[model samples]
Target: MPGVMDIKRKIKSVKNTQKITKAMKMVSAARMRKAEDAMKNARSYANKIYELVGNMADRVEADSHPFLTARKEVRNVCLAIITSDKGLCGAFNSNVVKKTLAFARENKGVNIKLICIGKKAYDFLGKKEFEVLSKYVSFGGKITYDEASEIGDKLVDYYMSEDVDEIYIIHNEFRSTAFQVAKVTKVLPLSIEKTEAAETTDYIYEPKAEVLLKEIMPRYINFTVYFSLLESIAGEHGSRMVAMDNAARNAGEVINKLTLTFNKARQGAITNEILDIVNGAEALNG
Candidate 1:
């Protein structure tokens, strides 16, 4: 068994760690609220645009718009992997990485390109044997629409020029404060099945489906990218907050165990000293 002083030192160390985790938990919770609001506000717009595009695409021939046209054969794929710039968020980053890896293996023959959005993704996938078109990081737990627009523009150019046959966004979808689900969303050659609600509704074209699609298609792509980033940011913060809370709880448990060990050790030492004194006094008297 370790000495009482050693146990005391360990208890102190664990306490300090617990404090840090608690602080992180608080910070993450605040950021999560802010990000979550942005994500929520964007949800309505994203859904409407999604519905509009899907309905319009269904009305016109698929090949009428470049964005809606699918390639004959998928030769190259571009994956935009979104993750947090930092760690200590439990399995948040690892989950996205695992999903991405599975996707790569499933399409092993295809030439895979990468667009790494966060440091975690870049640190892992960027160093691999893939062509990384771009890498973005250092957002510091916040991102603006302009940054997302820049990334969206790059993806647009790549798709228009046939740089990649397909583009997919691999990111975490914000489900709740304690849970997030990783999703693989296709970005290029856009396809959305008409929902029951949308199927019942019919729309009259303003200028023409082709003209509207040509003008609004790029904006749709850019907003899609921006919305994905917002979702990812919110999910990351929620995951981190939950992770830090769990860490703090675990540290508290360790501190309690260490305290128990410390008290037992101290008691043993005191008992031993008492025995020594009693024995010496008895011997001297005898």
Candidate 2:
């Protein structure tokens, strides 16, 4: 068994750790609220644009947009994996990396490349078999639409130039503070669809549907990239908040246990001292 002093030191160390965890939890909580609000607001715009683009794309000819044209063979593929730059966020980054690796394994023969959005993703996947075309990081746990658009421009260029036959974005979609699901979205060779309302509604475009789509398609691409990045930021904050909360609670539990041990050790030392004093007195009297 450890001595009383050692146990006391352990308890003090745990308490210090608990303080850090609590601070991190509080910071993550505050950031989560802002990130979630931004993500939620963007979701509305994302939904609206998705619907608007789908309806417009359906009315236009396939030849009108390169996005509408499907590649004959998907030889080269690009996977854009979004994650947090830092750790201590539970499995948020790992899950996304796992999803990306799974995708690579499933498609064995295809030439796969990478576009990593965070340091974690690049740090992990950069050493892997896939070629990392680009990496963007160091946002300090905060992200903006302008940054997303800049990345989007890179993706647009890659797709338009036929550098990659298909493009997918892997990320964690925020469900709740405690839950996040990794998702892979195929963004290139755009999958245009007709909404339920579009199937029946007959309307004419202000200019021309094809002309409108020509302008709107690129925006849709940018929005998709931006929204995914927002989702990742929100999810990162939520995951980190939960992880830090758990860490703080565990630290408290450890401190409680250590205190108990320290008290027991101190009590044992006191009992031993009393016994020693009584025995010495008896010997002296004898």
Candidate 3:
């Protein structure tokens, strides 16, 4: 049995922890709402841009641009992994890391180059023997379009340089406040499926098809990267918010249980002292 002082100290510690968890839960919930709104507003424009680009690609010959070309032998692959910078989110980082490892395993022998966008992914993959080509972890809690553009520029450079045969983005797409789906979307060599999404009847080019293709092609890739980052941000916030809520609830439970234990211990001590006093008094009377 712990001394009364020890029991009291434990209860005080638990109370402090509970307060912190509750505060964190509130903060996360507020951030999650803002993130969700940003994602929703950005998604439509992002989708329409890609769809328009795809439809234009459909009308033109496949070999009009090099980015549209799909290679037969995939020797080198670039994986752009998106994860949260910090963790407190339950299983958010783990899910992405596990899927990425599985992807690496499945695509054995192909030279895998990693492009990590978050600190969590960078740290997790850095520990492994994988080849990490580039890492961008500067994005704070808020992800801006500039950050996305910078990341996209690297992918474009890699693809244009022929350093990587295929580029894929693996991220958790924001589904709901409590749900996220891990998705791997091919971002380079501009898949025909993407072109199919934007299929249109006829289109007029401001300049020659070649010139327009050159201009629009890179933007399409940049926008895709941007969209992914935005989605990932929303998903991260949602996961964190839910995780914090759970943590706060669990902390409350712990405090409740500890308080009960403290009370029991204190009561036991008091009862023993009373018994001792009573026994002494009886002895004196005897």
Which numbered prediction scores highest in TM-score against the true structure?
2
| Lowest lDDT 10-residue stretch of candidate 3 | 192-201
Residues 1-286, model 1: lDDT tens digits: 8988889999999999999999999999999999999988888999899777777876777788888878999999999999999999989999999999999999998999999999999998887888999999998988888888899999999998999999999999888988899899999988766455545455677888789889888889899889988988888989999999999999999999999899999999999999999999999999
lDDT of each residue in 76-171, candidate 2, tens digit only: 999999999999999999999999989999999899999999999999999987898999989888877888888988998999888999999999
Q: lDDT score, residue 64, model 2?
A: 81
Model 3: how far is 237 from its true place, Å? 1.3
Question: Clash number for model 1?
Answer: 0
The model with the greatest lDDT is 1
**What's model 2's overall lDDT?**
0.88
In angstroms, how far off is 135's CA in candidate 2? 0.4
Which candidate, 1 or 2, has the higher lDDT?
1
Residue pairs with clashing backbones, model 2: none
Better of 2 and 3 by TM-score: 2
TM per candidate = 0.94, 0.96, 0.94
Please list the C-alpha lDDT of all candidates, in the order they appear. 0.90, 0.88, 0.85
